[model samples]
Target: MAKTDKQIAQEVLDAVGGRDNIASIAHCATRLRIMVHDKEKVNQTEVEDIEKVKGAFYNSGQYQIIFGTGTVNKIYDAITGLGVEGKSNEEVKSEGKKQGNAFQRAIRIFGDVFVPIIPVLVATGLFMGLRGVLMNEQILAWMGMTPKDISPNFILFTQVLTDTAFAFLPALVAWSAFKVFGGSPILGIVLGLMLVNPALPNAYAVGNGSAEALKFFGFIPVVGYQGSVLPAFFVGLIGAKFEKALRKRIPDAIDLIVTPFVTLLVMITLGLFAIGPVFHSLETVILTGTKWVLDLPYGIAGLLIGFFQQIIVVTGVHHIFNFMEIQLLEEFKYNEFNPIISAAMTAQGAATVAVGLKTRNKKLKALALPSAFSAFLGITEPAIFGVNLRYFKPFVCGLIGGAVGGFLASLFHLKASGMAITVLPGTLLFIKDIGQLPIYLLVLAVSFAVGFILTWFFGYSDKMAEELKRAK
Candidate 1:
């Protein structure tokens, strides 16, 4: 029999040499991330040898103990003890500053750079999507109205909030990257300002069109690097390294002044000339390759997206698609590909809702209902953790339904005419351009039906049914 969460927690605490050995603890997805004062005190071999422990790491001056899903919080609670160290400590402390292996460092850096900015991005992205839905000509036409009649100020207010973050994204990335690299954040802000400076010639567009624009310093191309990612990350890394090197080499009296100047010059040069082009080229290659691959049999792309969307969301890599959406919006003035993702989101929500309605266990049903609602609102974490993943069959059902919906939408070339409002039934507003909104609705209906039917049929395995009945 599997150990109870409380038993696992206590055992994990014991393996790590008790609560005193730990400085702090946090959880992400399926791991108990812990900070320790002394790595040697924790028995690494023994911890890994434990039945539930997947791995352990000692890096960035912290020891991390990995556990599978459903066990991290219990272990964290046991380690921290009751009524003393609440969950908020996880947010107050810097988990990324701790040490581990190379992969751990990479994961820490990624989380540090992106996690803080997600809520802002999601809120802004969703707002912009909603504006598009409200403003689309077809949507207004269907409602017996016109865009010209809408108040200009109201439109501008919405547009400003939606576009501000994107327009100034390089600054955000630079700030976050600086934090990731352990550098002075002000320097990152300066670098970000230079990227979006209006005076800089647009190197990105120069070769394709204009030939008369003057170059920066007559050698380096003055590319408008707004929203650039790799440039800031690479530059921040170089800056941190240079600062550290300067501190060690210079006399103590002159260290501060010299270190800052030397690091600034080196980092700026590296960012503008080397990192900028390399990142641009890499992004180009990846986008081209993805487009080519996705152009293959439609079913293949649909299958891939359906199966991995939730997994990607869990790992926080879904921002990659958010990046793609921004790129498409900049280049094409709108996006059509996002609707496929919307279909998958809807399917997941439908499955969770079905499970909530069908399950007899009150606790499970309570968990599933809230998760379903969150998923419908374009927040899938609750659903992934609480409903779909708990009963694996629901997740599978959702994936199959999503794939079918995606294929049909692609077959009819049913692009997202505009962004959805809240990823709920409100997204149906974008279907006005399909010329047959009812057909689009029919596809979503079928997807929901599939999820509901499949969950009802296959979700209640013998073991689960027995456990659920007992719980009830």
Candidate 2:
């Protein structure tokens, strides 16, 4: 008999060593992220055997189980029905800080702050992609118009649709950061607004030499924090702590009035005069360092990341790279990270495709085909867990394919205008530079071909399925 979602959730919970062993639970777009009190108590083999569970793995101190998109929500709801409390990302971050070392905690916090903000950015990115498509000379000529003849109102509308969020990105970041740090989110928005006030020149303009620094207190430098990340984050942290500290001394009667007043007064000054400049420089240094590494000669750095990327995905911490991708878009206006990572994903998908075609095991074939499709659509957990990682050899083969693709990508100087979307849909990114699109196709083709051929040649055998009992 087929198991219901409740039973699947129950089985998952049981396979995770019961509700008592679970520290916290949450779900993302495709997986259940469970923080466990004891990793050793969890039976991975049993979890993999459970009905409706596609795959499972441990990474960033969380036990992640794949149920696949729409279904994961049902199972998550079922788990909640069983009296297990599902925590928010903030709660998960708080618990993660307690359980993780410094680096792990940092990664958790970064994910926490940015993940919530991504939906808006993605919507905006899609609009930007649309605008890119509309601006294409070929597209324009096909539409029987030229750039000079295009409607100004349409351009203005696209500008607002595509650019407004990124222009005032610090506000969104500050709002999210304050929530992550345990503060009133409304107050965080208020502070974020001040950081990007119209009175101050915009950060983007400052970069183009259209805006100059305004000195405060006769010596301290101040500029708008528009589109910046570090400044708002730092201010939100200090502001949250300041607001909490103020609430302690002020009497309850007048606390609301006085606390916000004092907190904003002190924190805004700190942000403008001290915190903003310092952290902006730090953000620059970090961005510079990343650029330096990613740009290494002969695509050496790209080769390394491509080879190990899927290995990192198995650990479930691969989502953290989105932050790096977004930072690339914000700082450099182009993402070099996506091409290399997409190469890795395409290779994984290719390996799964080869396995599906070569395997006589009907069960493995059923899993491999859809997972490969998902990987091609920029989701890889299914491919990595449902097929590649289990066989081990195929995953390594995929890495080799990815390394070759990344080298070719680097050699061709591939770039993307946005992040968060990849593979087939990522073709939208190269719309403005149609010449680069074919080069990207070449990278994907090479990656896919290498992974498919390698996996078909050595990744599996008919006897192996019987040995592993994966045969239907």
Candidate 3:
């Protein structure tokens, strides 16, 4: 018999120590996020066994249960209907931040600030890919047109589509960071504009020696922080604190004018002359180190990253890669990290599919199949937590497949035109070059085969599947 949403909600609440134990509740794309007042009172095993619940785990001081997208929304509503007040996602996130340790909090900050900006980059990436298709020599030749035939105005229009987000990325990062840090977002935006003002030498130009940086105090290098991430983030963080401090001191009568005026003046000075140079240099070193890793011989770099990428995801520190990918795109205008991680995700999904095929239990099959499909679409939490990790061996098999796919990706020097999406949808990122799509398909195919084959033969058995069903 199918469980109603209200029934599932009641069971979940009961499993987690009733209404009093829950401090707040929220829902993300796939999970029911709950901040509980008493962790010891909740029965983790029972929660996992609840009908319609895929899996459960505690992360960043919140008890999260995988309910799979739309299902979670229904469950959250039901939970709220049971006399427990529901909080907004932001409020639950704030509670989580307060409960988490320093490192967890920091990672959460990175996610909070960068997540809002991904859509623009994703749209830009798609635009870049579409433009590549439109301007491809082979395609153009077939159309009886040459590169010279394209008008300058059209090229400029393409630049607007493909380059606008990246050229002014610092502003977006700063604006987001300010919101996350509880400062006035407009002030952050203004300060970020100053970082990339036309008067300063462009960072990319300075990097290529096409333009020299202005010498401030005969030592400080002044350049436009175009496409930079860390500098803008730090400036936003500092600017918000500065603005907040000023708000406390300034009287209400003149506060509006004085606060923004002073905040902008001080932040822009620090951002360009101090914060920008320091963080930008640090960002360069990080980028250099990342490049060095990718450049390791015989695809060792890919092997290590591919093998451990999902492991990092399990630990919840994978958000760090967002900034890394951002930096990679900024420095090289290419994202090598995307293909590697995509292979890892594809492998995990494949392992889940294998599990579904091997399982005789209808319940396990029901969870495993959909979870595997989701993994193919680039969301792996359902596969990772709901199926593969539960079996243990399938997860390891997926890691092995990822390591192989990652090695091939590195060997062929496969790079994506963007970040944020991977696996099936990730194909859009490789559309920039005609040769890139085949290599990407090859990576996915090999990853899927290895993951599926290994998990079928060695990683799972009918006995294990029955055990999982019984345990549930």
RMSD, every candidate, angstroms: 7.3, 3.5, 1.9
Ranking under TM-score, best-scoring first?
3, 2, 1
lDDT for every model? 0.63, 0.83, 0.89
List the candidates ranked by lDDT, beginning with the highest. 3, 2, 1
Candidate 1: tens digits of C-alpha lDDT, residues 385-449: 55676556788888877777666655555544333333454455354344635556666776677
Task: Write the number of the candidate with greater TM-score, choosing between 1 and 3.
Answer: 3
The candidate, 2 or 3, that scores higher on TM-score is: 3
- lDDT at 178 for candidate 1? 75
Top candidate (lDDT): 3
Q: Which numbered prediction scores highest in TM-score against the true structure? A: 3
Of the two candidates 2 and 3, the one with more favorable lDDT, higher being better, is: 3
Whole-structure CA lDDT of model 3: 0.89
